[model samples]
Target: MKTWIVLLASTLVLPAHASNHITDSEKKTPLQVETIAQFNGIPWGLVLLDNQTAIVAIKNGAAYRVNLATRMTTRLTGLPNVDNRGQGGLLDVAIPPIANTQNWLYFTYAKPTSEGSTTALGRAKLDNNHLSDWQDVLVTNAVVSGTKHYGSRITFDNKGHVFFSIGDRGERDLAQDLSNHAGSIIRLRLDGSVPSDNPFVSDANSRNEIWSYGHRNPQGIYYDAKTDTLWSNEHGPRGGDEINLIRAGGNYGWPIVSYGKEYWGPSIGDGAEKEGIDNPEVVFTPSIAPGSLLRYKSSNASDWNGDFISPALALRHLNRVSINQDGEYTETRYLEDLNERLRSIAQDDTGVLYIGTDSGKLLKVTLNGS
Candidate 1:
């Protein structure tokens, strides 16, 4: 065995670009993190096709087909021109449950318009080594003239309806308005058609695709198969980040009942709680800047089963929340020693975890001796 050397000379002995795979000494579970691949730009989102292959979205207006083993990345062509402005670019990607038969892939990005940029969701067949027949399924009705707050996370429910989030685009009041798709999670049929049973389908003034409204740049969303619950995490203005159990037609009071204060130190609204709007199950004050969320039901690690894993950017760690059937939760921090700003995380069929970082590294997390 090669003996690891500890340099007593200086605090910063390693080079600036060195790969870090630090494990927490207090961790009871035997797990390991290995950096397997690297990208040229920031990897915003990832979807594993199998253990050895995956697709990654870069924030710099491109997507790549990545080989997990060899680290060979091929840029996927034929995507719509993304408005790669401040806080706007190619975002999340998802594969349908029927991908084996349909060969379809869904993506969300910041689409440019005459007015400005809006969050857009599109789907296309993955054929002939690139995206084909791609078209935008939904775009925000009101295209505001700002580059910030385009909440563009995508997830599919058990009913096969596609759900994607759009941020308020710096327009806080639009979240309360039912007429626009901004600051809401929009659910639609597979063919981009409006589901007739949608809450706003009968309302003449509201957009038919709105599922739940009053979100403020939700970057992470997941559908729990066991509980049939849709969970989302959004960034707060200064200190009031939230994790919510999403429901149809639910109004998550943003700018109205925020636990968070304003960026310059003022109350967001009247108070923390309101009458009709829903409150978040979890609220993080002083802000962790949550980037993505995952619901892990791993057979290998029974301790981690039925737990929610949220990777954060500001905190630079993976958060583990163990929940019981009664809805009580205990929180822990995983991969705390890595000290990297993680972007997205996913798990394979065999219970292996893959993590993407803002520093352009792809890491695999697994139980030791597995």
Candidate 2:
């Protein structure tokens, strides 16, 4: 095992520009980082079963139970066949918060279809080293030609609903279409049933599972039960990656309105803002390429309580954003020295953080003074 002790100094505060009375404060936290385990493939999803154990999902359609103390891994079985093409494969895994449903493990992966590949949600019970009662809960209607935009991640709300994201599947106009599940966040009951209170449940033309529309590729979705807030971070073409406060029935303008420029050096969409579209709480220009999101609540490290953290792929850092009561944000970037494409993040009961990197390294980060 290798270890590194680093002190991270907070960066300059950037104005959120959404609301007033945003305060800027500087924080200096000493970190103890340890490379707990290594893999041959990217660690796409990570969830802690307990303080000493965790379940990790690899991008190559493999899952493992990892021991945090000994750095040992046990392979898990019974996952459905996933299309490991382009950016599609085994993705996020999450455990529901409710006590009655806590035994079931939820997952999102790229399911291969006759037409192509689409994002799918599934659930299973962990029986020793293997999965039992494996079932595909929802096979999204997002099949298209390319595999680059399967923006899938799982999170559960305080209510009995599960939410997951799907990218535009490389088709830009599909984000605005209500008939398909592409480029949208989907909400469903724990048993794969559609909730009647969903935004488009009554619209025959729209998919009943849709919670919100017009998202490009939201790779990360986190629901904070304490604040009752849903947060998402998505990728943009060249610039304009966004961190949005997700709202039910709200439209987040994507192709029709974007702060990003086209790959061929042209402005995208009608403009950056439109009347009915909801604006993002934070926008990262030049694309940090956030792969996952977490609303960190640390009892051990009180300074980090209620902060939002995401792993940056393009910039290779741990991105942290502090949101004040007035909805203002102060941003900070950490761990650039590691130079790994951080993909997923999770926190333990004692407030220790586990980060999954694209380089197949599982990192454990702890606040030194805590």
What tens digits encode model 1's per-residue C-alpha lDDT throughout 249-352? 99999868787888788888877789999887767656878887888866575667777787888878777765555544555565656778988888887778
Q: Model 2 segments beyond 4 Å from truth?
A: 7-10, 17-28
| CA lDDT of every candidate | 0.79, 0.88
Task: Measure candidate 1: CA RMSD.
Answer: 6.8
Which candidate number would show the highest TM-score if scored against the true structure?
Answer: 2
| Per-candidate RMSD, Å | 6.8, 2.7
Q: Model 1 lDDT vs. the true structure? A: 0.79
- Root-mean-square deviation of candidate 2: 2.7
Query: Best lDDT goes to which candidate?
Result: 2
Q: Please give, for residues 64-141, the per-residue lDDT of candidate 2 as tens digits.
A: 999999899999999999999999999999988888774799999999988898999999999888899998999999
